[model samples]
Target: MKHIYTDLAVESKEIYNPEKKKEIEGVSVEVADEKNYSVTTVKVLNQKGSQKIRKPLGTYVTIDVPNLDKTDEDLKDEISIAFAKELKALIKEYKKNKILIIGLGNWNISSDSLGPKVIDKVLVTRQYFINYNKEFDETMANVAAISPGVMGLTGIETFDIVKGIVDKIQPDILIAVDALSSRKMDRISTTIQISDVGISPGSGVGNTRAGLTKETLGLPVIAIGIPTVVNAATMVNDTMDLIIHSMKEQAEIGSEFYSLLEGLSKEDKYKLIEEVLSPFMGNVIVTPKDIDVLIDDLSIIVANGLNIAIHPGIDIADVNRYIR
Candidate 1:
């Protein structure tokens, strides 16, 4: 069946709310804020909730910050700190210290460059740990990261590459970062999702590959992402809905046509809209024109977030001093 493609659990919850009861089975939502960022955490427990949400049974945390598309130094720092702190809280239960960070995307493509960009900014400590066979400094952790070029470039599956590395490094926890697609345009580059549900490379744009999960890789997996694009069909459908809503609000009350429009089910509307747009723009992906700037700024936010989360002894201030 045709449905909106979104990498956000909160959005999935929003979609399932009307159909389910007061609460979804095995699903919980917790919300908090950090400065200008709105952090939402969704926990999907059990197989039922996993099936309903179309995500694995784990916690998914999303941080929504304002003006991410625009360049603002102060706002970027705030988001980085917030993202890092939230990431720490999510991974607290995992006592493992050896961390392997996987940056999943093609750096050559700006729109898909989020993972590799962040990888460049990440503070690597694996060599230091491996060399000395002991902790080097108070601010460092056994952190290592990689950016395996996409399958088309390397001709190797993303999961396979990560699996090979995991087998050799034997890290306690695995963190994967990627660029995702959203159903709403406004959400692009403005939202970050960190989850323990693992991840499927290329799943954000519908080309789902193998997933990197604990069961598959023999270790816990943490996935962090920011939506950078939107499906054209989904965008068109939402626009049509907005237009319908505007027409209904302006049209005379009790009109036959307005009532008829109101009576159309959401599923019917989405399907009809997708069918109409599929012929022309089915595989179209929409991204902001200023994505070049957004990617650079976002990489810092995400890289710092991962740094603070992976290294418990260091905070954002310490990271700033170290990076500088």
Candidate 2:
């Protein structure tokens, strides 16, 4: 199988079916159009679906905001609401339980700083509950967060750090936020993927560590990720597709050139592109020029969604007030 590096499960499904027509045996997909964005739910139902998509058996919700690059408050709110709705559905049963949010990334890098930035804005009430010994209120649940730097900086495995905290705090559930890589350029910084199967930190960049899942943590883990980068080879492959499409449009349908273009296999082309770029730019990752600003806006959107979803007492209006 041709390895296509993408953190979004929707992309994986798309790759599985380039024509977007056939349905995988055990996988199911449903898409709903929202006011400002669209929600795509891709479920890997069983082992067959899991192996077909190369994803674990779980639900992956992708919030696609086409105008994500635009800095508009209304758009942000709409996306945040959609995000909260999806996240709420996933953790509805544990809404009143103790939740630990782990922000997994390096704060120094702009592309990878989303996790830490979100931690800055998320409402953390666990400290209050611990210090004052306050009982659970309707307005807020016991929430705690940590921005554990990458292993390179902390010299400690992320899972170890999280395990220790989980053992100490004994939170009922875990929510991990991190930056991810996508196969499409347009998805970079514009897509949010929420999954119930948990995530392997640094997996998108090929430095995968121990996975943070129910099997490992002994608690349900919800992973929320935004694509901050895309593989350069994948971008080139997409560009090639566009070019071929443009040529085919101008050429006669029955012409030899048109036939050749139609017969060009995406998998073979992607492999060729990867081979050609390997020597010059081995596993090169690409991010948008405005990634810094994109991350700032996205972090706020994600934090607001998380705040509203995890704390029923907080709504969109009150969520921004808590964010710096």
Candidate 3:
């Protein structure tokens, strides 16, 4: 299916169907799987809700294999071993000398903390392998990671910060991890995309971070991410769900075997309605009571994917099987 997007005012709007072209304002919306490089706004603010500071959003996949089962340390171990194997393969590509891991995100913001969080956990094999306490030794370390905060504080552009860092350290490869946004909520929990092409930290939002692409960084760049937020249009979808449920209760709407929501109090009714329509709410940061544990469980799975992606010698078949 093709996705059509339009911008109205400061916000961008989107419609997946070309048939909705007449429904959308401004240009005629057409449906095509491929995107026009020039057409930036794929979707404008289709629906409105809370006015939060805008942030660039996309989907990211995170994996953490060890925590698969509460008591199953064996499974976790197996996952880790497998992950190590896969990562080793990827690492072999960087036979060239230096590897720099750039954790891209604003550490201050909870929504953008993925990059920094994962960076802290990375196991720098070179650091521990050969015990040494010398400036040359540290400088010669194969892997070095940095979490360059958002451009807001540093006065310098992201590209410039990376360039300065690069000039000083000179690494062979760059791997960046950051949070992203997704139009669909189902993908929020588990979706990791790795690409050699670097990333634009705040492109989804109006504030564009200096991009860290192969062209800009002058090195091979790999990006890993998880979707941290959903847009307001998803909120509109949630509201419509409530409206539809209310409409469905009307006799004119469903007269045959009336399944009316009659005896429940206002609070109870609202709760029930919300429960019934939760799935339509895209990328919900809030988890339902029943799904809370499940969501938490998935976090480990995502972290494992990232672990395997970075470590370069981990076999992830076991990890992939558990997550799948």
What lDDT does model 2 reach? 0.90
Q: Sort by TM-score, best first: what order?
A: 2, 1, 3
Q: Show where candidate 1 strays beyond 4 Å.
A: 18-21, 135-137, 253-255, 321-324
For 177-249, candidate 2 gives per-residue lDDT tens digits of 9999998998887899999999999888788999999999999999999999998899999998887778878
Better structure of 1 and 3 per lDDT: 1
Q: Which candidate ranks first by lDDT, i.e. highest?
A: 2
Q: Write candidate 3's Cα lDDT for 1-324 as tens digits.
A: 111111121122222222334334322222222121111122222222112112123211123222343435455445444433433444456543566777777777666667766666554544643355333332233567778777776767778878888878777787777766554444453334443446878654334567887788787776655555554444344455456567666648453333444333333443554455567863234322333443334335445555555544433553455433
Q: What is every candidate's alpha-carbon RMSD to the true fold?
A: 2.1, 1.6, 11.9
TM-score of each: 0.93, 0.96, 0.53
For candidate 2, give the lDDT of residue 133. Answer: 84
Cα-based lDDT for every prediction = 0.83, 0.90, 0.49
True-structure lDDT of candidate 3 = 0.49
lDDT of 1 by residue, 81-148 (tens): 88888888878898566889889999988999999998898988888887888854566778888999
> Which pairs, if any, clash in model 2?
none
lDDT over C-alpha atoms for residue 109 of model 1: 89
Candidate 1: residue 46 Cα off by (Å): 2.1
Model 1 has an lDDT value of 0.83
Q: Residue 266's C-alpha lDDT in candidate 2?
A: 67
Q: Is candidate 1 or candidate 2 better by TM-score?
A: 2
RMSD of 2: 1.6
